[model samples]
Structures are given as structure tokens and as C-alpha cells.
Target chain A: MEGRERKTLVLGVIGADVHAVGNRILDYAFTQAGFKVVNIGVMASQEEFIQAAIETSAAAILVSSLYGHGEMDCRGMREKCQEAGIGDILLYVGGNLVVGKQDFGPVEKLFRKMGFDRVYPPGTMPEEPIADLRRDLGLA
Target chain B: MELSVKQMDPEEFGRQRQEVLTAWPTGKEVDFDEAVAYQKELPAAKVMAAKLAQGKAKGVTYAQPRAGVALISEHIELLRYLQDEGGADLLPTTIDSYTRQNRYKEAQGGIEESRSIGRSMLNGFPAVNHGVMACRRVVESVGVPVQVRHGTPDARLLAEVTLAGGFTDFEGGSISYNIPYAKDVPVENTIKYWQYVDRLVGLYEENGVRINREPFGPLTGTLVPPSISHAVGVIEAVLAVAQGVKSLSLGYGQCGNLIQDVAALHTLPLLAQEYLKKLGYPEVMITTVFHQWMGGFPQDEAKAYGVISWGAVAAALGKATKVIVKTPHEALGIPTKEANAAGLRTTKQVLNMLRDQTLPQTEELTLEEKMILRETRLILDKVLELGEGDMAVGSVRAFQAGVIDVPFAPSRFNVGKILPARDTTGAVRILDFGCLPFDREIRDFHQERIARRGRDEGRDPSFQMVIDDIYAIGKGMLVGRPRG
Candidate 1:
């Protein structure tokens, strides 16, 4: 998995959230799952995510927000990527996106509308995202 | 401008309220006349101060859970479930992050998005964006008194809207909200903002409407020494009292050690009352809240419940006025509504069982209480001296000079010089006092405690110990030990 020309993916906890537990967990999981993980750590901004994506030539940007501000924090991330000449980059986000209990369908749709290619719900397992990335990137 | 802990003039407050109300379109919905009338008509059960006083007088502890969603209707339903199903004695409307940052336009967008999708898209109830009438719906829907529990540094507008919407309690203070939550916000600015919030509460007091105010107690909620948090709590209480607030509740986060947690709960009220009386607010009604563990929780649900039950026991034996409950799913991120309700039920069971019991006063308990009291006095006294008798000015200066430091806080304004680690018995003690003005006796006590743990663990006290302790509980251990 290490030297086999593995696909690269950028991951981080966006905005001002410092919930590093999940970020670290995801990093370990993705690395173990054979993706070349470029972990940006917590408290990452939009520009940082795009810059990392460009630098790593990553296939996707997986954003996690655990402090319940994902909706506000991830508002223009896709547009930011587009502005930086990476409009085709796959964007994924998950965790508690909003403050209250809402159906996951609309939340997924909202992120999709925000230009995210894939949106996961809170409590989603790592396997789901890893598998989805494999199919989305045509690496299966 | 240098801000002093002083009451805002009524006319000045009114002028500010005008500006605050116009910060968002929802501001126009707040009419003081109508709000007061609405509040006067609320049932006694829905009044925060009345409920707290009742619990205090009866020696019973109320239970509250943190919960909120983006949609108002869903938020109302969630509170109802917590009240009727979870048996919560009080309710909380945890605001979304957008509202906490005063990003009302984003919150408005969240509300619209939630409505379109028939789901909540924000992490909390956007009371400011929901406007006063929408907030009123939440108040009317819940059977118990509701408090606005949020981490907003500048909560002036939030207070105006929520109180006008009939929220009877508000949580957070300049220091509590800033040090742990923000990275660049200055202490002086938040202190000035909160003065406006308190003056608004005072205005309600003048009109015979009682709202309970709580200073966020668990600064960083890591291995913070009891004295550091206690000092902040007492100072916030003093600051609130000066702003015409009549009902105040000082809080402490559960630190996992029974004796130290009990001692903190015991001494916090005594110290707050002492400070309030000395500051000429002898009539202010004081209460206590015990927050469940605020640090990293174990990932296993069963282990998490063990943590929750321990916090419940502490809150009960400590005789807190109310206990903030935590869910077993805490380690897994935002808890489902059922999980939130489960925590409330667990807490309620503990409180009911311990109603007729009390922790027997022991010699060790007495020593811990005295130690906490002595350490708290040293920090608070230095803060007062730094401000030249002004708690607000002293608070900013104290943080600047590292006299009062919270471990693991994110604020750049914080000195971040203090380090804390659990002693042999798992009681948090200062590993490094930084520039705290503790006398030699207090410093020696902390040093000796850490030394004892160091001797037992066969290693010198260092940053590794702090690092180990942070992950210790999550690994099913109180003290992190070297791998065999």
C-alpha cells in the first residue's frame, strides 16, 4: 500500500474546530486503507484545504466538522476549489453538520448543492468513505 | 478602552440595545414592553431563578442536558422529549455556531436550508435568526424553564433576543467563553460585551423578572486545577453581581476525583457568597451547577456510562443545585435525541437515589476544601490587586501577566503557562504554577503531590505526564502509565 502508486486524498477538520480525536482517527484509518493521506490536522481554513489539495495533487478533500458548524464552515469550499483551478476535485464532508436533528437526506443534498461530490452523516464508519472514494476515483 | 467591572447606566444600555437589536433582522422583533409582559405571564415552573431557588431550598438537584437543532419545531419537540421522556427538570436551547459568532446571515441561510429539506442544518437553535416570536414558541412548547446555553463571547444581542423570547437563564462569561473557545478575541472586549448582557438581566430584575446567569465553569475542561476554575467562577459571579444581576450560579466541571470534586462544589458557593457579600451584594441569591466531565470520554458506551454515573454521583453528594448531564455517546460526536434522553434518565436516577444520602464529612474532605479555598483566595486576591480593586480590569491584567491561567485553553490572550496533572488520587494539581501568585505553602503542596505521583509511577513529573493524563481516562485508566 505504501509504494504502489496509491491515490492521494487530503483530509482535515475545517474551520475553528479543534476536535482532533476524530481527525487523527480518520487519518489512521485512511492511511491503513491504502490512500496516500495528506492530513492537515484541525482548525484548517478553506484556502489551506485547496492549497493542500493542489500541492498533494490529491483526488479528494474530505472535511470533518464535529463542533456542529460544518454548514457555515464549509459554505464556499467547493467554490474556493473551483476558483483555484480544481473544479473537478472530489469534495466530501461528514459529521454533525447542523445543530438540530434533521433528516440526513436534505443535509446530504445541501452539501451536494454546495458542490461537494459526496456527503456523509454523523457516525458514519470509515469503511464507507474509503469504499466510496475507491469507486468515485475509479480505482476499484 | 479599559473596561472596569461596573454596571452600565440604564440610558446607555438602552442605546446599546437599539444597536444590538438592529444587528440582524430578528432584532426588530424584540419589544421590551411586550417581552416583559410575556415573561410576567410565564408559569413559575418556567422561571429559572424560581426553580433554582426551589431546588436549593429543598436540597434537591435538578438535571439538565445539552441539546438543540436548527429547526425551531424540531428543537421544541426535542426539548419536550427531554422534559417528558428524560424527566429533565430544566431545558437548554444550545445555540448554533453561526449565532455564537454573530454570523446571523449564515444562520438565516441554515434555517432556510433546514426548512426546505425538512431537517435541521445547524448545530443549534438559531434563536437570533429565529427572531423573538420563534424563540417564544420554544419557551411555550417546553414545560420547564429553558436556558440559552451557548459559547458566545459577545452575547449581548443573544441575551436581548432570548430573554425577550422568554429564556430564563443564560450561560457563559467573558473569561469562560473566551479563553476556551476563541483564539484571538481580547478579554477586554468580551468583558465589556457581557456587561451589557448583565445590565440587561438587571433591567429584568428591576421589572421583577428573574433570570439566572451562569459563568461557564470548565475552562478548557481538561486537567484544570480546581483553584483556577474556582477563581474564574468567583470572579465571574462578582462581575455579574456588580451588573445588577440578582440570581447567580457558579459552576465546576467534574474532575473525576470524589474528594476534590466534592470540595470544589462545597467551596465554590461559600467563596462566591463571601465575595458577593463583601462587594455589597449580600442579597444576591447564589446557587451551584456541576457539569459532567468535559474532557475526552471513553469511546465504549459502557465505559462512557461509568463516567456519566460518576459525574452524577459527584453532583448528588456535592449537593449541586443542578447537574449538567452528559450522554454515553459523547465520544461518538453529537448524540442522537435518544442518547441525550438516556443521559438525562441516568442522571435523574442517580439524583433520586442519593436524595436521602450525603457524603460523610471526613478529615480529608476538610483538608481538600481548605486547600481549594486557600488557593482560590490567592488567585482572586491577585486579580483584584492587579485591577486595583476592579475585577474586570484585574481579570484582563491577570491573564496578561499569567496570574490566572487555564490549562489547554485556545485563546492567544491566555498565557498558556500553567500545566496540570492528576495527583496520586486522581485529583488535579498544578504541575507547573507558571506565574500564579500562589504563596509558598500552596506551591509546595502541589509540588509534593506531583512528586508523590512521580515517585509511585517511577518517572519525573514532566510534559509526558500531562500528555498521558489527557488520554488516560479514554483508555480506561485515571493515570496514564508507561506501557509494560
Candidate 2:
């Protein structure tokens, strides 16, 4: 994990959601923006993300969920990571994080309450998060 | 011409007479020649000779059509234009708008338009054109040679009957083209459906013709068990045609409703390319569209799908022979006539500009794109290593359920291992916006999914799709159902 100025990020779509178009775009965009992204593809689980993060010694974990079931599925994932001994790693999630119509304030609060460091609505460009990660890790 | 010249030699005659006698015990040789002669107003002997010659001609000539695109009736004009303008390079790109809803009147318009323009290589007729007359008109009309799709009952029966009657080039099968609507097929039924395709392929080959199976439907959802099985079955049937199946209608993008992860979408195109190639299919028509199943984001978000531009990248990298563009306007409904025209125009424009891109120059990537590319390569490798005795590809669902298992997982990388980044600055740059609110409605939208699955339905659907839920909630749209 050394000598590489670029940070390693674990990215994927979680659970039964098999959406790949956006995931691929994110992969391209992140790589274009100078991040090493390990895209786990579709139908991923919390364990998969944790394992990749741990294995890659990733700078952060970025989860994308397009299916409306993200809230139900992504809940407690941060705790799960803490149990896996990588609690301090940054957690960034975007895309449809819940099912049905709801408010963003409570939604972002909920993800934060669940321990996500940063949350984005669907269509959040990767550049914004990468820039934040750069500043947070003091790479900038 | 003497009667003796038309007649068989005595020994041959005796052999035929005795064989006929034994085959039908007590059957008398009724003077059928007299009846035929009366009908034709010819001598009995001449009539016999003519009947004998007609029977002889029954099984003599046989030729098969080559692999190419099957245009839907609606896209015929645009296809013809693509052809006439020396766009032969685009022939493998299939036309999709001509669904089962339209009639022959619409079909004729495409047919006539193609004829008027003098480019007949574009293949496809209406899904409902099931009779011999319609088939014959289509086959002969766009005579530069093309494959046809038949979905109506008459089309299936006509394809069967006509091929039996010596029109060997006709294609048949309803289930193959209707792949998108079949997500919930019982795994068993799916298996049977594919087995049936083998029989259909054999029938055509018996008539001395080969068929290019249309295994993917663009607007349809995932390529589930049935379609996957048919794809493999088509390969086995290639032997009937005295050659291996060399072309496949794979990578037809559907709504991607079953696809919640990049793994699934990556699976379709990669599998379509490598598996088909491994199974000996040489040509593949890959469709990369931003259809509804891609988790419809608001237009702005959807545009970032990068599928349109990157799809070209993947197709080129995957070595796809053809790529079909889903008109950006398709998520609304059947594209308007203007939209359809614009779609074709965009496809042409993009393909023209990308004709010489020759990207993926270095299949090997720096650490930046390494993990993603490696994950994709590993998946493709696992898909290819599948052997005859192994569980079939159609059983991907079961495969995921641990009914069977592939050797690798998506996260199989070393920890603390940072992959190197390459090509830091590319012309096509992605501009990122800092974190923003979910626009109250989008958040409330996601809450409903939680309430329904979490509180109401008692189903603990994962929250991995928060983005989709938030987006759908904000838009006040739930694709499959109305949220309670």
C-alpha cells in the first residue's frame, strides 16, 4: 500500500441489487480522477465490502445502491465493519439509499447514526468525494 | 420422348412394385395417373413423368443464411439508409423498436422504404408476420439477404411448414426473442425452454438451413435461465448445420431490473462475448443502452451512467462485433418517430466518431483501474472455465444461492495493497459535485421502502440501494409498483 500517491478505494453495489451501469461509470470516473478503485460488481454484501476493504487496506469504502432497498440493506453495515476491526476507515455511500419516498435530512441522519462518515443522494459525482478524501487524508 | 425412356428398367420396376406391395398389403395400384392426366389435360404417361420429376425436385437444393442483424420492421428505412451509404460495417447491429404491438402496415413501410432505397441486406419483418405470403414477400423483397424474426402463431407455423415445403432459409421460435419478460420462470421450466430450442434448430438444419438465434431482447429484463440455456442449446445445434454456431445475439440490454450491482451488467456483456466465443460463436451483436432497468435516475443522473460512452469502450475491449445504442429517449415509451430517427442518427454519429478509437491499447492497467479490470477479468475467466460436466451458466441464480459456486469473489484483493494509478488525465473527465441533500422528497421516498419492506411487508430488504430509493422517492416514482 506504499509509494502510491493514489488512495485505494473499495467500491461496489450491495445486496440483491444487480445494477452495473452506474457502478462501471463510477469505476471509470474514480480511476480518471486518480483513485485506485476495487469494484466488486453487483449483488454484493456488507461482508464482501468489508473483506475487500480489509484485504486492500483501502483508504475508504464507497458503497453504491440503486435499488430502493438500501436503507433496509445497508443498516448496521458500519457496526459490521467495526466488528471486523476496520471501524475507523471512512464510509461513503450514495445512490438510492432507501425504498419508497422519504426525506433526505432524516435519511442522511440515519446513515450517519449508523456510522457512515459521508452520504450522497443519487447522481453525486465522484470528484466531490475524492476531493474530500484528499483533504481528509491530507493528500491535498 | 418415348414411353420406354421415361419408364424404369424391368428389374428396377419389379423391385419397386414388390416393395410397394409389401409396404401396403392388399393395396391395389389405383390409376392415379389417369386422374392427374385428366386434371392436366395431358397424356397419362406424360403426367406420370412430370409427377416423378416434381417428387425428385423436392429435396435437392439447400443453402443456409449467414449470421447478421435482424432488424425490427420499424427500423428498416434507417437500416436501408445505413446500408446504401456503404454502412455495411453496421449490418450486425440489430434493430429493436419493431415489437409485437405493430401490424404489417407498419412493416410494409419499412420493407418498401428499404426497397426504394435499394439496400436489401437489412433483415427483419414484423413479429406477427406468420404466414407464407408475408414471409415470402419479406424474404424476396429485401433480397440482398437477411434473417427474419417470427413471433405470431402463423409465423411459427409458417416457418415450420415453409421450411418443410423447401424454403430452408426461414427462422422460427417465439421464446428466444421474448427474453425480457421472463424473470420469474421456475428454474425447471427455464431448462425445458432451452431444450426445446435445440429441437427447433435441428428441424431447420434438417431442411439444409442454419438459423442465427435471437437470444436477447433489449427492452426485456435480464437474460435468465431459459435464455441462457437456449444460447448454449443453439451452440450444440450448430453441428446439425455441418458447422459450429459462429454468431450469437447476446448482450441485448434490457431494463436491468434484476441488476442491482455492476457484477450483473458486467456479467452479461463479458459472458456474451467470451462464452459465445469459447462455444465457437465468432460474431456477437452487443447492445449497450440506458434503459429503465438501469435504475432510472433523474435525467441528469442517468446521463452520468457513462454506459453510452463507456459501453463503446467495453464493446471494443470485449471484442464485440456490433454495438446497439438504446435511444436516450426510450425510458419514456416506444420512441416517437422523431426520437427513433434521432436515436439512429446518434448511433451513427457516435459509431462514426469511434470507428478508429482502438482503445484498451494496453489490456494491462496501472493500479488505478487495476482492481476493477482484474475483477472483470476474473469473472470472465470463471465463466469461460465452465466445463461440460460443470453446472450450466443458466443456473447463475442457483450459482449465487450456493446451489453451485464460482471460484472467485469480487473482493479478492490483498489488504493494505494500493494499486497504482495510470492515465491521471483523460480528455473525458468526470466533474464531481460535493455532497448535497437528498431534496426532502427523495429522502421521504427512501423511507417508504424502509417502511414497506422493514415495517409493513416485514421484508428486510438491504439498504445498499439507498441511492435508488432516494432518487425514486424524490421523483415520486416507484417503477414496479405504487408504494403504500
Candidate 3:
């Protein structure tokens, strides 16, 4: 494939969360990493993510939530994508996914149940994922 | 080719029953300047002068030198960097000593330090909101425009704080459980504050001081619909009181949640379209966070949130006048200088790139893209209205009552809710209602038309339409002049 034609990634913060600093950084880093990234930014709803993915023919939808209520805010995001007919589109979520102190084991289970393809803990950096992505997509 | 001209059409005769409204440059600003003077003198000047004199006598300075140095130095560096690199500078304002131990004070100080550090990283940028008197002191001592902020018991105190800060440019108190409700600085305080500000302008007129008003507080963070609406209303009200007030500053405070809402993003554009039409492209400041609950997320998650989409929206679409960027380490407690700097650096990098990139806009929008934006805006508006209604009854109560505890809103539109609907019988039930707007329909039509035109031109649809319609619509409206 030519260098000009690379798959795009649609990324954002879910629900009513307004944390933006991390989102900005990821947009820059991803661009540097050579991914055509379409960043929807914070407080983006599931529909916004799905639609952006469709419009861009994106390879994945990366959802970042920092307010502990991610579990609450991000619940069913995966299912919504599937219903939108992009069920094959990969969904990745990270950050503190639940409010206060919640059990990680159960939270992971809950997210998996909700439909996320992959889930990371509060501090999962983007570099590792991009590396994994390269390997998974045979880019490496 | 000669242009076809409709020459000598018959001129309509006599008895014309039409009223023609022509642009009458009433030199309104001149009259406004005088009114500004009168209002400033009446109450604003006296109250501010007395309060500022008192604060100066009391003299609040940086409390912890080590911590203060760390914080202040970060600010200085950030300001210097941005100035040197981006050529984007800010008002000069720095804190002396800040509160120790208390979470709220410490939080406020930390935000200030980060802000200052970022400011310093830029060249030719000055600090703002140093303190009421402190700001004045800096302006007097340094001979640069200084930012001054005040928090008082009431509207009268707001006036006093403004005066004490040696500023006609000022922001209101914290938007938390206490300060905004304090009997002295009640929600009605803007009324009082502006009344006094009006009088102060009058005083300035007599004395010949060129000062404008800068109003800031978290209108978006209110978890209520009218929070921002009310904040705008108050600004307009104050402007009415002080006719010559040149500028106004308003923003959401610590509102990571609101920024996350697709609906809230649209509000800035609407505000720019409406209230700020006359300002000729005023910078609208907005605040967004990265960490969980504004902090406490792991580094990777935090970085993603900070750098990826969240930051992109804030800079590209939000068209923020000034953004108060939060660090990931906030949840862990006060950020070390390194951590704070890293966050600022990341933000700076995003801003730099966005400037170079093409973003989405509505006017030159694709049908699908425009549909998404309009639907998102509509959903968010409805949700915010509900949230606002709940806020009117008290947001804290609403939160407790579970009205806004979860993100789910009932499905009433076909585009559907951003939050997920319940899953029953292994089938995910989605809420769908509402028709698309005319603007969105028009956009979609043009997108299809462009695609067809591309086919005729032997070019790819996406190729010919390289320009981002959604961004053009969003940011264009945000920074564009409105049609009469």
C-alpha cells in the first residue's frame, strides 16, 4: 500500500467528561506515529464516534475517559457501535473507568460485557497500544 | 462576453409605503463611554477603592516560598516559551504566596501555577488574575496590562475586590458550594458588582484611566442549563449598567464533564453567534481537564485524554479564547513542576498542529457530517435543558436523586442518545427520535452534489472535498461574523 493511503482512527473522550489535555496529546502523537487520526475531542457521544468512523472508514474507535464515571458514561458504547453497523470496528477504552474505588476485575468484566474489544487501566499509554496495533495489523 | 444588465427598469412612483432602515452610526461608543463613566463613579469606584486599600493593608502574599517558587517559576517558563515559539502571549499576573493544606486553595494555586508557567513559556505574554491588589501592584510596578481577580462575600464585595485588586478588569468568585451563594456574594452579585463597576467607570472617566471589564467564572460547570445562560445574561446586564465596558470574559470552571458533552461544544458557537457578534472576534476562554474527575487517571490514560481528541476539540473546535489546561497529576495531589510542564508542553504541541491542520466545519459540510453535528447539538441541548432544570432545583440534589448520576437520557430522536440505552434480551435497545434540521439537510445535499461533481471531473469524492466541512461550520461560526 502507498504511504499516502493509511487507515484512520477516530478517538475521543466519552459522555459529559471535559478533560482535554490528554486527548490533545494523543492527537499529536498519533499523527506523528503516521496514523491518520480523526479526533472528535471531549464530551463526544457514541453517535459522534460511530459517525466519524463511518465517514473516515476508520480502523478503530479509541475512547478515553478520565472522570471515574467512565464505566457509567461509557456503558453500552460498544453495543451502540455494533448496532450502528460497525460491529467490526475495534473499540479501545482506558483511564479511570469507574468512580471512587471500584474493583478492577469486575469493572473489566463489565466493560467486556458491554462490548469493548480492549480495555486498559487508568494509566495505559498510547505508545504500547500503537505498537500492538502495528503488530496486529502487520505494520511491523 | 458582455455581462447582461437589467437597464432602466421603471422607477417605482410616489406614495411608497416602505420604511428604510439605514446604518446610522450614532457614534454609540461615544455616548456609551460617558455612561460608563457615570456608572463607574456612582458605586463601583468607591467600593473598589475602599476594598483594594483594605486588601493592600492586609497584604496577602505567597505563603510557602518553596512551593511558591516552584509554582511561579513554572508559570514564568510557560509564558516565555509560548511567546518565543507560538507568538501567542497572555496578560501578566502571578501569585505571591498561596494557601497551604486546604484542598480547594491548593487546587486553585496549582491551576494558577500551571497557567503562569505556560504563560511564561511564551515571549511577550503577561500574567493575569494575579490578585486584586497584586494585579494592580504588578501593573503599576511593571507597566504592563495585568489580570486581577477577586472573590468576596457579596456583589458589594465583588466591587470592593475589583477596586482592591486595582482593576476594572475582573472575574467573579469560585463556582462551588459556598462562594457563589455567600450572602455577600450571592448569585445576584453580578447585578451589584456591575452596578458598582458602572460607578467605577464613571470615576475613571473623571480621572482618565483606560480600563475595560474582563468577567470569568464557570458558567458551563453549573450542571444546569441556565448556568451558562445566566452567566451570559449577567454579563449583558452588567454591560447595560456600564455602557462603555469594552470586553467580557466568561468560561466554565473545572468543567471536564461539560466539555465532554457534544452539546456543550455547540454552545460556544451559538454564544459567539449571538452575544459576541459586536466584539469582532473576541477570544472565548474555556477550561478542560484530562485526569479522572480532573485527575487520578493512570499516566497513559491521562496522556491519551489530554493529548488525543479532548485537546483537539478544545483547541480546534472550541476556539477557546484561553484554556485553563489541567495536569494528570492533579488527582494524585499537587503536581510536581515537571509533571505540570509536561502537560503544558503536550497542550502546546496539539495547538501547534491544529493550526496547521484542516478541521471540520458545518457551512461547507458533508451531508453525513452535518447531520451528525446538528443531531449532536440538538441532543446535547435537550439534555442540558434537563440538566439545567435539575440544577435549578440544586445540582447536588439532582446528582443525589440520580437525575444526572448516569449519562443515559430517554430515546426521543432517530439520531439517538450519546449514552447507551439498556440491553434487554441480548438486544441493545437504542433510543431514536427527532428529525434532521434544514441546515443539516442542506449540508448533506451539497456533499452529495460535490461527490457527483467529483465523479464528472474524474476525481475522487473525498479527494475533491479535501476541505473539512464540519470544522468549517463549527470554527467558522465560532470565529465568524454573523449575517444581519
Candidate 4:
């Protein structure tokens, strides 16, 4: 256990979102914090993320949506993961989760119900997810 | 390996020119000797290099607006409005998307549609499809010097058509245009194509036409670190000069921080001159252009004016040769003529007010300038080393290895590994310096600054800051500190 191989994480910007800067940061942050990050880059579909996760045997899928269409783009992502037979793969979603400055409490609750292991608001830093991944992956 | 980025032989370039000019109907008229003579007869004031030289000598920051429409007359009208009403000291004929993509048939279709409809169906002026005479019509209609501005991966024919038509200045280079504009266009291909473009400009120079070349300095424009843009701009300048370009205007987009924006303008010309001299092109006349905020704009028109004015201030005080003005309708989409003129007037007002006063070199500004010079030199050295002292080879290889990645460029050729977010003071800092070849001290400087901001915000350094910064201007802020 002390010398176990690095755990994998699948990351990308979901939907027709062409936001690459944030996705790049997540890749670097997770890679620096000691995870084998498979970055799918911008304009990713949910199926693409799950496919990468299943191929890499990733411990989690970190989803970023900056174009404010995350709510629609991310719905049924958990079911897709389950259908892809990686149902238990950890799911983390963040970035302007809903259009406008809608109340975060309900948005977080809604995503949690949709099977996200963690939900980060628009300004949630990457450090928080790195810490969450370490604990969730049993690295901590 | 396919090695490109070398200066093309004149005879070899001539062989290639036949195929390039045959790409469209208008290519028939792009004759070199004829074009060179036409350029020589243009009034000296209408020559961009000469005008930019005067601007540099006078310490004036000329305002230029982006414009073009599909119809020739309509495009001319737009430029005239921008010139007469907007107070634009320089003019641009921005090429349309189809032309930029080399879809001349489609551009032709767009031109016909725009003509029949009595409005431009195309996004910009399709100069290539319009041929030499049509381009000359626009040039003749405009009083000031005209520059051809376009984001084209393969601009060989466009350069031929426009230059033959009487454009005095041309914008964009391989690295500058390819990385930021096209998602999958290989830099090598573009480098080769732009080499042809520069060689055409060189041929004109050989015949005594002093056309001005500008390396699009603001790659991706959104939160790009100055070191990265400077490295690309300086490299592009070298490549252009190798093909005999004598006049260059390197550009930089506003990065929100006054000291940093000014620092960038200061270092751009200084670094370009140093590299040109060191590379044996010591006499290349280098000028700088400051682009107004190229990020998300506040939808509120008043707030937008505030943003434009601040850019004007930076460009004026930093002593940029010209400032590319942005319209208030940035958030709303393509600006109307009135909105565009209003934006230009706003910028001109600020420039007029600040012309005499220099932002006294504050200690912070001095420090920033020193840091930019150091960082830019390191990247350029690595780039040259990568190409084995051949900048053309070096730039392509550097991008291949991610040694000079633009933050959010869509080009698959770009390794897309570097991450840029703002420090506490709103200056862009790298979050991920992977493969950049910066020394430990330089890396630590950026790390500590971002870490300091993280400490103040009660959060750790992460991508969240990048997101916040992306939306900051629209939200009426710059640093993007987390809300309580």
C-alpha cells in the first residue's frame, strides 16, 4: 500500500464548452498533487469522460463546465457511467454549475442527488478537489 | 523530420507563387513588379511603416479599429465612418472568415449574397475574392494608411492580393495566427505558408516597397502571460526579417494590470530590437501595438467605456505606436458603425488627454519590466536552443515540446499544457509552468506570487482562480477573489 501505483483521474470540460484554460489547470493541479490525470480537453461529452475513465481504470471523473450549460450537459452522467459499467467511479463536478448566481445550496444538493460525489461552486479552487480526491481514493 | 521555417529562395518562391496565385480568379493580377511600382507611388503618408515611424518619433499612440464588410462600397463606407467619426489614426480591412479559411468560392458566394442583399453577409472584407482592383478601391477610398488584418492559417494568396492591391501593413504570423485562430492547423504548415507571405513582402522590399509586418502579439488574448507572447512575437519578427522585412510592429493584448500592461509594451520593442541585433538584423525598425481588453466585456455600455479608456491610458503612457480599439458592443456581438465609432472616440479622448504625461517609472513598474525582460529572454534562448539556433525550426519544435504553449490555444499542435491565472494584482501568472524552460528562481517567483494571493483569499492556488479571472471583467472586478 505504501508504494502503490498512482491512481488515475479523468478530467475535461463537458458539453460544447470550449473552455480549455480551466481544464488545463485541473490537469496540472491533479498531476502535481500525484495522480495519473487523463485530460480529454474542452468540448467533451459525458460519454467521452466515462469512456476514458473505464479505459484508464480511473478512480474519479472530474467534470468542468464554464459555459453555464452544466445543468443540462451533465444530467444523466451518472447513468451513463453506470451503463458504461463504471458506475462506482467517483464523480466530481464544478464551474458555474448553473446559469446566473442561483443559490448554491440547492444546486449542490441537486447535483449530489444526481450522483456526484462532490459539487464545487464556480469559484471552488482546484486544491479542494485534490484534497477530496486524495481522501476519496484512499490516498490520505 | 520535415524541417520548415527557413527563408525560401526567390526562384523557389516564384515556382510556388504560380500555384498560390492560381488558387482564385483574382490571383491573376498579383504581379510583383507591377505591385511594387504601385506601392512606390502611394503617398508616403499612406505607407504604414512611414506613418508608424512618425508615431514612434512623436510618442503618439494611434488608434486603429477592426472593420470590413463583404461589399466593396459598404466596406469603404465603414472605414470612412471609422476614420471620419471615430478619430482612428490608422485603418484596417479585416478579412472575412471564409477568406481566412481559404474558402474563396464560399467567400465569392458570400460576396454575391452581400451584394444582392445590399448588406454584408460575410463577417469581413473578402479581399482575395475582390481581387487587386476591388482592394484598391477600398484603399483609394480611405485617407489614412491601410493595414490588412486577418486570422488565416494559409495567407500566401491573401498577402499577394492585398499587397498587390496597395495594403501598406500586414498583421499576423505563423505562431501568432495559427495557435490562437485555428484549432488543428499545424504550426509547421503555417510557418511555411507565412514564410511565403513574408518572402512576398521581402520581394516588395527588394523593389523598395517598405511594407510593415506585425506579428499578432496577443495570442489567445485571454490572460496570456507577456513572456509567452513576447517570445512568440520576437520569434515571428526574426522569421519575417530573415525574409527581408525591415519594419515590424509587435503587439500585446491588455492584461488588466496597469504595471504589467505597461511593462509588456516597454519590453516588447526592447526585446525585439535586442533579438534582431543579436540575430544580425540590427536595423529592423520595431514598434509596439497595445490591444484593448480582449476578454469578456461588461454588457453595460458605461462599464465598457471604462474598460476601453483604461486600455487607452496604458497604451498612451506605455508609448505604444498604436492602440487597437474595441467597441462597447463586445458582449452583445458585432458592433454597429456608431458603436464602433463611439468606442474609437472614447479611446482617442483618453489618448489625447494623456499624451503629454508619462506614468513616471514607479518602482513596481521598473521591477515588472526587469522581470518581463528576464523571463522573455529565457524563453527566447530556449526556443533558439531548441531549433539549434534556427528560430524557424526552433519555434516549431518548441511548440511540439510544449516549451512555448499559449494558455488556451486550440491548435492541437500546441501542447496545451501551460496554465495561466492572475496573481493578486491581476497580472497573469502561470499556474502550471510545465515544459516552459524557466529557471527555478523564475518559477518560484510566479509560484510565490500566486501562493500569496491564495493565502489572502483563504484558499489554495487552483483552476478556480482561472475561472474567476475569466469572468472578472464582466462581473466588475479583475482579481476574481471568491465571494463571501
**Tens digit of lDDT per residue, candidate 2, span B146-204?**
43433221132223322222222223222332222222233333333333333343433
Query: In candidate 3, which residue ranges exceed 4 Å CA deviation?
Result: A1-140, B1-88, B91-134, B137-145, B149-168, B173-186, B197-217, B220-244, B252-309, B362-484
Q: Write the per-residue lDDT of candidate 2 for residues A51-95, one digit (tens) a residue.
A: 999999998998887644466558899899889999899998887
Which of the predicted structures, 1 or 4, would earn the higher TM-score when compared with the native? 1
DockQ of each: 0.22, 0.02, 0.03, 0.07
- Minimum summed lDDT over a 10-residue window in model 4 chain A is located at A95-104
TM, chain A, every candidate = 0.95, 0.92, 0.90, 0.96
Instruction: Show the colliding residue pairs in model 4.
Output: B387-B394
Residues B46-92, candidate 4: write the lDDT tens digits. 99999999998998899999887788888899999999999889999
CA shift of B363, model 4, Å: 2.1
* Candidate 1 structure quality by residue, lDDT tens digits, B1-484: 3487778777877788888988988888888888889999999999999999999999999999999898878898899999988999999999877788787887888889889987676778889988889889999998899999988989999999999999999999989988877767899989988889988888888888999999999877888888899999998888888888999888899999999999999999899888777777747888999999987778678898888988999999999999999998886667788989999998899899998888999999999999999999989989989999889999999999999998877677888788898899999999888999988898899999999999999999987687778778778888877676
What CAPRI-style quality would you assign to candidate 1? Answer: incorrect
Candidate 3 chain B, poorest ten consecutive residues by summed lDDT: B13-22
Q: What docking grade applies to model 2?
A: incorrect
Off by over 4 Å in 4: A1-140, B1-6
Candidate 2 colliding pairs, count: 56
TM-score, chain A, candidate 1: 0.95
C-alpha TM-score for every candidate: 0.86, 0.37, 0.36, 0.80
Interface root-mean-square deviation, candidate 1? 4.2
Residue A59 in model 3: lDDT: 91
